[model samples]
Target: ILHSQISTIEKQATTATGCPLLVRCKNFQLLQLVIPQERDCHDVYISLLRLARPVKYEELYCFSFNPKLDREEREQGWMLIDLSEEYKRMGLPNNYWQLSDVNRDYRVCDSYPTQLYVPKSATAHIIVGSSKFRSRRRFPALSYYYKDNHASVCRSSQPLSGFSARCLEDEQMLQAIRKASPGSDFIYVVDTRPKVGVTTLVCVFAAPSHGMRDEAMLPDPLREPHLQGGFAQPCMAALLSCLLGPRSSWRA
Candidate 1:
């Protein structure tokens, strides 16, 4: 009986026998109720209507409420994956890539995690300077390192580039990335999106005239649809093809 599920409430009629109330839910669940008493049906409808639409701002969502925390409770789930342990598995702190503490104070990139792994050639000064070139101060940071080839998959926000926007440090950073992966001449940029509307999902209300009027109710219209197939899907076929190629140990 979640009020959020309620979409459209239709009052059929209030005859002598009873009142037929039709409730269409967000999930397209058609709820047809025939209340025996006319007054009770009106009361129920009014109650449901009030509950569905909260008048107060805070009543909209339960995010304001804070549950009591157990002082004695100690959860060890957070300690499962220590930074050092993960780096150890990757065989890092080598010649190609090294651990970076430039963002330890979170001054360089507030959006990024405090801990970061950058190219070995790029110094702390270069890392700090390069942040200005990229969006949200998200400078290129190592996400994965292929042990065999010293190849790395660096993640970064879009570069703040325009006609005149340029940074020498950012250029040096790219060079450092290239240097890390020896024998590799060029870097390939892969766009995950297939096309404009092939894999694109629009909001239910965004394009009312686009699709059929009585279309299937989408549960999560806001959430970006998971890429089952894309032109250049990141972290998988696109990046791995450049690194592993058609024939590799990772082949299924």
Candidate 2:
């Protein structure tokens, strides 16, 4: 069942532009940040720093893989380390590195889980491994990173029907939305593709029988002419709450 799901996700990813997925971890706090394909390494490194600042996490780890490459080629996964204070001192030297370096340049085994200690965090560790079950379990993470990470204006003023839907699959996001809506009519669309990544795209639409509400209710930023992409999870929740209704409460 899991393998089937992973296969479906890989197919969907083929259609979306690729992007690097950044994971920030400090003690028990873990946040995922998606760096659009258009952003350069420096931009991504800086973004990681910006994300960690508020939480006081001094460092973050970014990872990326190319599905198009063969097994041996794919084994050479990519990783980047962003140390906020270190970067500040050295003016942020290039921090991207190969995943093999975690194993002292040894080739990583795809079939078995590999544990690597994070240099920036003494107690933190990153597991680099892939399996039918592991990929299926964390499918949402795979899809979110593979898909083009961006936000766009709602092309159609109408409700969910014509408006562009954004994916919000992170568990943190779902909990926020569920807490806000509770027993409301809100519907969650979860992408269950077997791929390594999957995300829930929130769709907001009222029935046609109910007349459209005033457009003023939506936040001004969401109505702008350009599409805003690469928003972190908290921002995404706030945006969704605004679109849903005034009664929605966004958790910090």
Candidate 3:
């Protein structure tokens, strides 16, 4: 193993975490600055997850940037090159790598300069029933949209219809996650009153499946989520109770 010592500075201003010097370095030549970013920017990537019950596949969409995007596409913004070939290109030895369900209609071309667009519906259900079983899961690290709050019943502004109605009635705290994240739809039309049981909800965003850090900065559960408005106490307690509740009890 290579061994080296980190050089120390005599004086420096500390960050909120109270560490002296904003940048951390491994050696004289290697410098690192850890900028604080939003939590959702990190949390969406998952390798495996155990659900309470069986889950059905829903429409899946992936947002990506194509460095070789054409001029026409570039004129609009970033491009989404089909990454169905990712497993092949990555050269993983497992056959399961190629089993990605990339169905037709699940693709989209994002214009460049802009690196965001809604892809076709995914063929998998990201979340499912019973809360008793485990399943592998994968989602993009970054899901860019024009605004945040698309998942909020109050912010979506859609008429009381199919998707909108479900969003309103769903009691799952995770339901509103995508909307409060960065780069989601800005306007929310549904009401948050029914879901306002918690005054504050803390959401922790971990690094990717490859792992980035032991812990990422998590938002205060008592405060409003990053992009959405503040949460209420009752709501917070209810959600926490569910998360911390006895697992076996649910089944019993």
Candidate 4:
């Protein structure tokens, strides 16, 4: 089966809402898993709405790993090309995209090293930053960061800052978030492990008219029941909430 853990989430104005002057941040965590791809991932599908119109989408972004390439492989030359013609010929979205390194050595963190397919429409932005985090007990994690007209998506080994102390209590972690995201309004939770109880931190750069959302702090008792001495489950919960909730606004 295909398992998913939302690590980060970001949103601002949508095509429906139009671009607004202010931005709000709501960081949360959530995830869902799908069955493993048997074969021909191109068969997987989804849809999108443009200008209140419906558009069918095929082509998917696959996430994977490369034990051969270390951290350095990610930086050099990455490109997000508009593969609309290629996708349309294959019955995919005209805006469908494929990530490529200028050299085309096959990206280290594209999808499942084996390849996990997701609809093209799911990618709201053309370019996405990618990374991988590996823990001893579980499978290596792959994360994708994207940026659109309003929302910016990012993933890190560290947490993002600026929601509220009630939601995220670590000061140092929050500082890291601020450094990574200076002007972003929201952070998207793309990958995370809840059972492991890893805490993620993110920050907000802009605020809407109402100020910010009041998120309920998770109880200390219910979180980090018996994991490591430093692990925090509440942060993972908050990460999921931001990712799976409405794409338009943040709740926490």
Candidate 5:
């Protein structure tokens, strides 16, 4: 690590989480630092940056030198993701969509997580029936709901029916999903499944009232998604693009 010993300049003043820093060398070396003091932490971090990249004299090095940070009102790291807090940010449990623990015990869908957020228009019967029709009972569920346009990102496994088969209840549930997002004129499908799977979703997800768009082929995912307020992981860029559209800036 770059600053492993942590030059204990101040014994009294110490960071709550013990100021940790990571530096990646060009030779594939990852160095870590845990400066205890606030001033020392800042000093060590800046020193590391300067060491990595030298600057000219009187150039105001710190002016346009911005560093990425993850923080809140309090100091913490590797925090557990709170589902309620996350959904609250999305402005859920409104007239259109609601949170249901119907699958709390994972009885309806073993693969799906508890606390299902779905369209309020969908009935209990419709959900149960939809589960039965889907592969591994992984029925359609909302992944993200855009507050700006009220556009949603719903995910689901392939329907059990390959192409010819159809499920009335499954169709009804998907129809309710469209009604929940009134802002969008079209229901864009981002299918990562094979040809038969993609074709199956199109066959079942298509409704009479809503237009269907097959965006199965996702755009090249950005290498650094966090630059534009996107998903932290680069792989998720494809899903984010498909859900939010090509010209989207959905904050993580």
Candidate 6:
């Protein structure tokens, strides 16, 4: 019966929106336990990792199970999982459970990392800069930073004095932007700086205007958020509104 169940899940993983499965080995016996589904594959993976607290596995494998791939590729689709590399690449918190821990005190804080798997047809633009306001002791500090572009990834820790960082001119960044249909989705990795804690990463999605250049009208990164540091959400919404205008649905 257990074997039948495992086979069933393995088959589902290749087609349905799948969840992570926990594997245990004891007395030379292996067990696969399916985790509950979450928002998406990424969320499911994170939840399962937290449940397996203080993970000590010597080897971890992630099966693609993508039906679009060839049969041979799907059959041999298992790949080693590297948590550290994934965290860095995805801009995820090093402490898998940190979001939940932080929420206890800062209940308003977002509980997930900022990431977006942009479709190939869409173009993405990134901007990194500091606020115009300065502290008594320090100059404008590094503010917003988020990277989840699977095709091309970039993260910056340095502060930008002005609009010094331009995604349109950067060759590496352009690689992620493609000529796609007008109104296609655009991903923006933004920074949300709270008054009392570290800056929070936020991912914003918008569609480009059909007539205008394939770019977003971003705010002057050198300036302050419209209302202190909580401008990330509004900024994203405004951009989408501007791009889509009144005719299109403003759903991100």
TM-score per model over all chains? 0.55, 0.15, 0.16, 0.20, 0.49, 0.21
Candidate 1 residue-wise lDDT, 148-229, digit = tens: 7666778776455343244678667777887788747655433233335422323432432332111232112111232335
Local distance difference test, each candidate: 0.67, 0.28, 0.26, 0.29, 0.63, 0.32
Point out the higher-scoring one by TM-score: 1 or 4.
Answer: 1
Candidate 4 has an lDDT of: 0.29
Model 2 TM-score is 0.15
Off by over 4 Å in 3: 1-231, 246-252
Decoy 5 TM-score against native: 0.49
Clashes of 2: 17
lDDT of 2 by residue, 1-252 (tens): 111111111011211444444443433343333334534534655554454443321232222323576877655543244433333333221121111233323233232223221212111122122111122222111010000111111111122222322222222222322332323333233222322211112223332212222233333322212123443465556545544434344323
Q: For model 1, what is the C-alpha lDDT against the true structure?
A: 0.67
Highest TM-score scorer: 1
What TM-score should be assigned to candidate 4?
0.20
Comparison by TM-score, 1 against 3, better one: 1
Output the number of the lDDT-best candidate. Answer: 1
In candidate 6, what are the lDDT values of residues 26-113, reduced to their tens digit? Answer: 2345455444554555564554444344242222223212367787776563446543455455454422111122122322222222
* TM-score pick, better of 4 and 6: 6
TM-score of candidate 3 on Cα atoms, chains taken together: 0.16
Model 4 lDDT tens row, 81-187:
33433333433221322332311232333223323222232231211221211211111122332222212222333222233323222222223232333334433
- Clash pairs, model 5 backbone: none
| Candidate numbers, best TM-score first, in rank order | 1, 5, 6, 4, 3, 2
lDDT of 4 at 19: 25
Segments of candidate 5 deviating more than 4 angstroms:
1-79, 161-164, 195-252
